[model samples]
Target: MAASQKPDNVAAVMKVFAILEGLAAQPSIGLSELSQRSLTSKSTAYRFLQTMKELGYVSQEEESEKYALTFKLFELGGAALEHVELIPLANVEMRKLSEQTHEAIHLGALDEDSQHIVYLHKYDSQFNLCMNSRVGRRSPVYSTSMGKTLLAWMDDNRAQEILAKTHFIARTRYTLTSAQQVLDELPGIRQEGVAEDREEAELGVRCLSVPVFDRFGQAIAALSLSFPVVRYEEQKRDEYMALLFDAGKRISSGLGFYDYPFSRS
Candidate 1:
């Protein structure tokens, strides 16, 4: 075994983390002091620092030959925090929507690949025959109301790219099974400020969704209400849409988007 290498490379990993922590503690530090603080050799620390610098997690000052933590780590942390913050901020409005309708309420966001919508938070319907779903569940983007709402608000080129990559499997007879069919609906969805799934993803289940925007006015998530078709009333659609739109606006405002484009009137 190499002197600097530990069993299964654990020591190397620890040394890297230790150096990171040391750099975090100091505004800037020299190679000698950093290696000593991290309990690693100067050569090992230099190699790790060079790797981290290349990865954008650390920066080196040319004049002083000192290493400092970079904002890349902070930016990653901020993104994670923002996602975490979204749940609580959205839950408040979700709870209100649940109380108002006693129906299933879901908060969904685009999955990492932009090919699906993942449920992040959900409030089950009070009724026994309501839609069944859980957090972390994923559904195809072309067939779900939440998915359409997300796609509708996205930039045209990006939305087109995602649509092009989608596998339009027909989950139900009503599912849009082609890119053109899905694309044709986006304009109306954007105009109405809501999207609908008329038993497209699952039989007897209908969903209505509104876009939730971020600080940049980009849609970050979709707030949706689901109901059994038996309980869904054509006349009451507007009433439910109002509730969802209100909730979407509130959650978006919490995320720093005040210019919610949808109006109930």
Candidate 2:
């Protein structure tokens, strides 16, 4: 417990991760290029690639001998989509909350590439929020409730790094104009464990959301409820905020993750 693991003993795992990462960065790659890029010896690269192929994480093109990722990676991700796991749990709860409040519910995760909210699930509200976003759509994190909840939990430096290259697209009059304003709101968001979007993403939409944290206190995803601003009047903001937070916590607990403010991992 007191000693660091020896390098040679963990080299195999490290090599595999490097290979996977290299493959991930490229659309498709030949073995020679992969071996060179990953800096692993050809034999070692081929051995690990063969292992990954068997496991269905990598596949070789029959036409060109190039390697690409396979749906087996999705199979691995599917482990996290279990009903008691994060994705499935969020999906079901979002539907339940949408039915209960008659407001659209959504789940989003922070994408490493754009720091945008990558949509996962969207529950239709009976009252119709009029949003047409679907799964796999990307929205600016600066103005979206999903983005704000996850960003509100990030550390100052980490958040700045993400938003630095980020272009603050003004989707509406209510969209946040600068990173400083976003940084300022984080403290209060951290205190309350919830974030609100008042017509930030659109002219008439209002969103209330809370982050879904893992057992390690990392915000891997977020849960949100959206409705028309006319429906979620200022008088009801606090009440609706409470309901969304409760739903967020329930899903977190249901996933076996204790709800806490997200740690900047």
Candidate 3:
């Protein structure tokens, strides 16, 4: 609080971020150049750089001694993006789908190990009865429409790898119990551009899902509409599928996947 004393904490934070911004603007730089870019003394920049390096956000090349940002920042960005970017983008489409059908809509993504689907967001149906689910709840990938849609879009090798680790305990009589059985269904799901859970994960609950692709054409998530069997109208299946696919395409487009693979069948 003394006049002669600087606000050490605030100054240090500013300097650290200044250095990070400088490093980000350039591919790589030595301590002297980095100090100039960040507008700090070489010693101060070096101190901050060393700390950041230890924290894995900055790295110095072995041969050049030039410091640069690392994949850690990219990894952190991706992690932040999943919740920050994806949910908001998907929520817009989910709300539209919910309005159209007045049915439960869900946005689900693969968990860290890729063995399960975790609900990231949902819109409850207008009806008194709907699927009991919440954000962050995890479900087996083999028994849910969202899970099947995600798997159907994955390459066989990767799909097989995930299936190899999956425990195919039958959630219900309709649940596919073997990897081969699910594998056999993938082609049809892919061809139809949608997947169905015919009371697979839970009795009397039927769901349909379509893939939400990312810029790289990877199925980053799945969008689904769920209804109790009593509320489901078999004749309106195609209509519901169209609504889900429309939302999926819109959401995928917002994610930078302009060429969504799914087409009406």
Candidate 1 ranges with C-alpha deviation above 4 Å: 1-16, 27-70
Which candidate achieves the best lDDT against the true structure?
1
Q: Kindly report which residue stretches of model 3 are placed more than 4 angstroms away from their true locations once superposed.
A: 1-69, 263-265
Instruction: Report lDDT (CA) for all predictions.
Output: 0.92, 0.78, 0.90
| Model 1: how far residue 120 lies from native, Å | 2.0
Worst 10 residues of 1 by lDDT: 1-10
Rank ordering of all candidates by TM-score, starting from the highest: 1, 3, 2
Clash tally for model 3: 0
RMSD, candidate 2, Å: 12.7
lDDT of 3: 0.90
Per residue, candidate 1 scores C-alpha lDDT tens digits across 1-265 of 6645567578788889999999998799999999999988999999999999899999989999899999999987986787798999999999999899999999999997998999999999999998779899999999999999989998888999999988788898999999889889999999999899999999999999999988989898999999999999999989998898888888889999999998677
RMSD of 3: 5.8
In candidate 2, what are the lDDT values of residues 145-197, reduced to their tens digit? 78888887777788888878787878888889888888788888888777888
Better of 2 and 3 by lDDT: 3
TM-score of each: 0.80, 0.67, 0.75
**True lDDT of residue 201, candidate 1:** 97
Task: For residues 46-65, write the lDDT of model 3, one tens digit per residue.
Answer: 99899998989998999999
